[model samples]
Target: MHEMMKAIATAALLLATAMPALAAPAPVYDERPAKLADATGVRDYERRAVEIPMRDGVKLHTVILIPKGAKGAAMLLTRTPYSADELTGHGSSAHMGIAIDGYDSAPDVVAAGGYIRVIQDVRGKYGSKGGYVMNRPFVGTSLNPTKVDHSTDTWDTIDWLVKNVPESNGRVGILGISYDGFTSLAALVNPHPALKVAVPMNPMVDGWRGDDWFHNGAFREYNLTYIWEQVATHDNASHYELPEADAYTHYMRYGSVGALASAHGLDQIGFWQKIKAHPAYDSFWQEQAMDRILAKAPLKVPTMLVHSLWDQEDIYGVPAVWKAMKPADKDGMLFLTMGPWFHGQEIERADSLGPVHWDSDTGKWWRRNVLAPFLAHYLYDKPMDVATVTAFQSGENRWQKLSGWPEKASSAKLYLHADQSLGFAPSDKEAALDYVSDPANPVSFMPRPNKQVGYEGNPWPTWLTSDQRPVSGRPDVLAFTGPVLDKPVAVGGDPVVHLTASTSGTDSDWVVKLIDVYPDEVPMDQAMGGYELPVTMDIFRGRYRESLSQPKALTPNVPLKYTFALPPVNHVFLPGHRIMVQVQSSWFPLYDRNPQTFVPSIFEAKPADYVKANQKVSVGGTEGSYIDLPLVSAPPAE
Candidate 1:
């Protein structure tokens, strides 16, 4: 009987040995809606508060989260100047409805992933102790010193996260959108040893030039959201009440975009105040812009940058930043992703899944694939298959992978022609058209701030600033349309403006727009829809025409070939749709009023000197001038 029992035991052991032993299967995480409530699998989270020490001596308030039963894991850090109490602590939780509707917070995402999550309030907002001075941003420049700013603050924060957070495999990554996105970018500037990756979406970089805040040069003073933030809240974080920010928040919200200021009883916002304070492109704006600093802030690790094609706030910033990164940093490491959405549309609009065709939720994929694996391999001994760059083209509605941006060998040039038309023709004689740009009622190619007052929030019900149409047909605006296309022609690239013409006045501005005429029969929306559909727009204040950092006044009619680089765009001109360019003098309060008299600087211009000037956009011979478009095609369609 003993021998038989032994034989049976031996057989059972052999069978068990044949079956492979599973190594705990990565500890399943509760990612689904229902599973979020599964405390057995979700709870046991570890949380703590610490004042992250920065190089500048300002202690930033932070909250660290460690997944239960999952140590020795990698870390993901999200730092914000908003409110570390909320972002890093308990306030950003679902109970506050800031992080999610019926879901958890970013900390929850990291906690569930069995990783370490660190949230820090940037130097001067919320529980963190410091002055909230976000109006200023950093670009790599010798003229500007390394202050206790977003970039430096970021470096210090990462230094602390990698060192203090226990079980943090030393490797760290950063993530945030909008203002927080700016903070994420800051960390990448001279990254620390453990900071492995960064993702900055709709980031607040160059606020003076292209941000929604200060278009051309005018102040979007009535931007309602920030107006409420400034008027009701004002340098105080206690009033960051989200639901109250909703228009339904107290009827203070106006009817349309234009009525918010009067409704809120505020004539101006601080953002506008800052613009008004600095009339010249001086240090006030230069130090705040990122273009000057991106190059010096080399990429130490793999970085993913994202922006919304329609991100009213930073529409032009994403591509600009991508192009600004030096070629050496282009180690197939700088990845870019553009979507059809706007700033914060992902969480704000309830879209965890990626855009229409991408299928995977961008943030999730970014985290799991790029960010997570980076941390794992460098910190926790894991491996991954990742990509360097990926961009989403809206018109095409598809994602395309590229080793580098400005992709290989794609070029085509469309020139400005006669009449209110657009095409590939050379200089012609169809006669120049004109328009009257009344200071009180200026024509616009793109919408400006409305009474609600901040970034593209034009107060009036006007067609998102499309009145720029008459610019080509009016007496004040000069017309240089392109010829009709024989085949389907599309434009996809940086829009360049070259105006080899002069002005009748001493000081003025040169505004050029690349328009896509959607067949005169596209039908208007009855409201402000009949204006112009500007595919691309750029403007150069005559005084600053030669140098963005310098000033030069026109000698009156002394042809000045001015160049203004419009933000890059990727648009397709189907058959029937025409490509047109409009040249004019003013974009007004949008780009601060140019003192038409060529004063020493935009600042020295006397209000009395604001005279009307005659600007010419002539073709042929000596006055030969035009706009150049970087046309692109390929990557096959998906």
Candidate 2:
């Protein structure tokens, strides 16, 4: 009887060994609804919080997740100035984890061979101990590592993580969006040996030139509400009370930025005070600029940059870095992906931006195909067909992977005519359009009754695609419209505006907006027709025409030409849609009004210095004002 039982057991073992092991089921792709819920398989892991000590002995608050028994898993790290408290502890909502939303958009990184996920509070933030420096500059070749910046802190954190974390594969990658994205960039300046890949999505590169803080040397005072919120929330992990309900009314009442610090007790806000002190692109701003510093200390890690055409803030960061890194990218590791979404929409929602819809959930496709695979390649030696540039061209509503950006592009000139006409051919007769721009009655960047005050509370998810009807007929704005298009004119690269104009005052501003005029015979519910959607726009301070550091007064009524570029556009004017261009001097409560009369600096300009100015857009016989578009072929027939 014993011999027979042994024989049966041996036979059963042989049969089990002969059968092949089934492959793990493919990761489920969740349809990202408006309200996200807990993921199906992501919670089968162990999560805990730890205090990781940096080189300087400052302990940074960190939350980490590891699969129940995950072994040889690569580490994915994201450090943010924002709170990472939601990532760990009891009864935490899986969907509420910002890092999970950013990386595991599929909501199942665990099912895809789980990684060791980590989120850390940067130095001087939330649970971290030490002083925080915004956009902390990289410290090069430090003899005593105790005296460190963001880069060294990241390196020290990574060292501790790889050593302490159980079953880690000793490989690391970093990624984040917005300020977190800026931290990812800070990591690349001096990367650890384990750091392999990085994706700095819409990084905050330059505040002084064209990001959130300034545009062409103009201080973005209204946008400062975001800074105030950051200061309040980062340390205490709580929301700050706005002094007033209406930001526009409150800020306008304050009169000047300096008043915020002096009268409003905003001097406690260190960054705001620093911003007021440095009005120009001075040494202070240069020291914090990521692009300038990266150029000096060229990055060696493989990086995948992602951005959007309508990223209201930080739109200038990626472009500046793209231009600066092209020469130093000897390893061909620099890659770029641009879409028609707004801000961080490339990660959060790429299916449609505001009212603009795409053929697929571009955001999902990007995560499942582009973003996920790219990170996996460097981390796990997975194969990837990496493109130099992967841009989603709107109007065509298709994704195009190209060898390079602005690839073999041709320029088409759209001339601004006297009769408010926009056409390819310049007007033979010289003409000009004039408008009175008053600082007291400045044009509202957004429609009135804008109750959305601060960046944290504003209903600005789709402000980039808002209709221009609000500002269309304003006396301070000049609209130049083109005839209905018989065929779609697709623009591929950066659009440049060459204006021949004169201002009545020594100091003024030039604001250019590119709009897409919808046909008036579409769905009423969707408001599809006659919708004047702004595609791209930029502001230029007239005084900074010569140099960003030096201010020059405009020669009054001299018709001096000002040539500047707008944020790049990746869209087409569909057939039957008319292209429109609007020129104005002020996009108020958006940009602080530029005093028409030059002062030593606008920050110190009194209410009396605010003066009205007459601005003109001129057409010379041959050298007329025009917009040069990077024209490309229309989409292939359906």
Candidate 3:
């Protein structure tokens, strides 16, 4: 029986193995291809991506957009560290207007004028193949012995565009805001023959002198995240996640910017390290100052310098570049346009900022009447008429056409008097106002619940125009109000601050703000009632008072004269409005904490270096604090 069972099992196993295994169920299949085909025939513009070879053989990623069927159209090129693909591909639409929309596109201008729009990624950024350098030094400079700079790259890009793009008219115009604006200005160093016009809006002329990184020796700590995001990776893939919602709390926790940066792995960033190495305005910064470098050569291109009156980021750039290039504008090639906008608000919605509203869409009007015509004049050879200096006068909300900037104004001194008052006359008796500035609890630059510094989803752009009432009452901030004005007081140029102040500590910082205080009742805008609107304001680090290039410790408790010029202003203090000046020792988070105690480098200051100090501002005597206002003559009848 056992033998019979074994024989049956062996026969069954042999039969199963011999029989063909039942065919496995047909495998489920996905018919879709591994990659989807590129979308075609739905766009109004032909988008082409190309690698333009620079002088050094590095190919820069460039995005070119030509209107369908466009012929002999001029090219508008913008070279930026910001991604060209992101800037040009803002939206996907059949209409060219919708496809090209971003910081520099000016969709309406590009479409109506039928121009080829080109956006190129600067070297070492995005698709560009090279190592990145922050505002790369000019060729032949000690900092950069390399032959390739922004100028050479721009020339190569323009040359490629003119030669390769059959739709282009051979003429090119360049315009951009902020860093793009810097590149626009750089293109003018040794401009390409194809480059006809250039417009640099709110450009960074100098990093260490009131542009981005430092303002008169005070480090702009708020831009540390910008440094990390921009310089940490070739494609800007790195992002800084804020540990705290309130930037004030986030910055205070670290004690110093250097500490905060180190904690976030920013030590690996070369620019941040370079910034730390040169805390003071030294040769490193002086050589990269675009304004100074451009001043050495004659203005080669027809350029228009656009400035935002309340430009939070680049308040000092346009003025500096204008001042430097004005002398070299031998052929009337340089123009200045100052608007009542934020950093880049000229390209965005500009009817209002915060609660302040202009009567009309000022940005649209400027673009149509000023920018478009200026571009057309050179690009399409269209006859155009624009003011040499076009300034939008605030308060009255009117545009002013002038022959030149800072237009022939008389100087008037606005003095700080007793009882927190401001007036044209000096105080008879010597008096002083005191406030304690503690780095531990420093004055917030913007209102509390401060978000990280950025354009979108942040108040950074309009913070300069925000009501100053929130900070006026702070113990660390001293508010001095002037009597109500019976008539209009037009200030048309830069306001100079003459401060006679002393600090209890060996080092300090001084922030002076020129404000316009509204009356108790505003019939038009109730939100603006009693608003302390800052007109022009800036900060100065006390250590650099003697010289920006050198740092010297202040004599404790001794009065020292601190003088610096605020940004240019074109606003009028209308009747019933009062002039105000607020002083403070710290504008924290926006600028790094001064530490109060002197240190070799504020960036490397220890926690113990930060101390509370009594700050005093003289309100009387010949050495009293006052603002030199460049008062203009009566305005033209509207």
Candidate 4:
């Protein structure tokens, strides 16, 4: 059996390596159909790579694309940690220069008719001077420009672009997705007069609460590639190339996250050290919380917050930042646009996410009607028709223009009943469903055939909406499913998982998955019969439930309520479909496993610390566990 397992693992690894390695999503560029400058006029555009001097004397590598008639045109800027060379090649259009996964053209630049597009490598990243600090805290109330940070770097970069660039109208607009989005937020903290508009899509606002690094105090193990390779390394963004081709096998061989660095001799990397040092939410992470930093000073510039329903990385931070940067008027400066797409998918191909289709090319629609007009209105003083908040309703396959996001959703509880069933009313009799969680055999985040190159790779972009049928019947995963729905139930905003459970061990990890179970029957070619689609999910390190900064061990077999959010969702459980809540203790490879035995830090745990945790989820009259969904009535009959 042991030899067979080894052979199987080796076979998987060889299969993965035999095929070409899938690349991560590329930097987003405008993918609009028409050209601002025609083929004849395209020859007139000039591209130049220059190092712009910042306040601290650190020069940032910048690429400027100026159209022939762009003398008085607005300046559209995107400051990114990604290489500027990749975003804009010598004199090529933004779309043509970079090979991106999804088609996202620079809508703001395209709609401005003819404009100066600037792409700059942020400090210490790819051809730029100065050390790169991840989500560098905003330097507050400091008059000295020498005491610089990301915000000041942005301020200095913009100051130089407007003054030095020729025939400048002096109006500047900044926008980006992911890390670039974070830089865009940094620009708002200390905005120059020329900075007129900012749009940050899926920006990293809080690393601790919900973002790439951590989710509710649980370390996101799968994203270690992002930290160790991409941001923490030298000027050039690096990637973790697996010798084994199977990341799961490679990670399992490492045993622990600390082992990955220590064995590899990578302690010198500043960000890697920082990640290991702060296992819990501490002052280090608190300082990097840009959302809290921005809360102190409201945004003065017109801003738009864009997010996808399936944004795997930074969904939590977007709405949080929007609320903090509150615009008093509903239809004013602060606005939100959400679509049923994955992270960066809104900018890419928005025809579908995984097997689920939104019934429209959402990316094209948003750029043409939503983002383009908003940018044009601000930059070119063009007439615009924009929504205060626009959200794409999933099951119904339509868009909703609301007064504001998640339109005053009402709460409804779905209780876990005795017979592994789900319902509204709590059961009068007490019952408990038990499962044994062995750290040795953790639940897979995605279905089998989950090798790196085959199913999904590192930075699993679309895994947020991946099918969940594989683990639905796993022995270690306790699933409480509802009956076939007679009517469609629309869930908007955040959903809270109220779990009353106990573990035989001192420490545990809790993962909650909200699923939309398709009917058992479907078309022959569809092959989606009884597919379990995860709408939203989240994990909680049990020790930090009381206080993220301070972790406490649980008394053995003591039943307690574990309430945590499954982030937010905007989906409908269509009639004939079923709603399911899967409770499990581990989602391996994606997250580091809990030792079950209490330890100061799981990162520092010995191999002996690993143990089986028999978990019991209670469902009854007094101790009934349920998920409170932000349910809303269907759109009023057309």
Which candidate ranks first by lDDT, i.e. highest? Answer: 3
Q: Of models 1 and 4, which has the larger lDDT?
A: 4
**Compared with the true structure, what per-residue lDDT tens digits does model 4 show for residues 448-558?**
435663334543667887778778778998888999998889998889999999999999999998999889976652656788888889899899878889889988898
Q: What is the C-alpha local distance difference test score of each model?
A: 0.57, 0.79, 0.90, 0.79
Ranked candidates, highest lDDT first? 3, 2, 4, 1
Residues 371-473 of candidate 1: C-alpha lDDT, one tens digit per residue = 4454455455667665555555533435555566656535554555545444455555633333434443454433332222322453332222244554455
Candidate 4: RMSD over Cα atoms?
Answer: 14.9
Q: How many residue-pair clashes does candidate 1 contain?
A: 40
TM-score: model 2 vs. ground truth: 0.88
Instruction: Give candidate 3 regions above 4 Å deviation.
Output: 1-28, 454-457, 636-638
Q: After superposition, how far is residue 244 of candidate 3 from its true place, in Å?
A: 0.8
- Among these predicted structures, which one has the highest TM-score? 3
Measured by C-alpha RMSD in angstroms, how accurate is candidate 1?
17.2
* Candidate 1 TM-score to native: 0.72
RMSD of each: 17.2, 15.1, 3.7, 14.9
* Candidate 2: clashing pairs of residues: none
TM-score each candidate. 0.72, 0.88, 0.95, 0.88
- Cα misplacement distance, residue 220 of candidate 1 (Å): 6.0
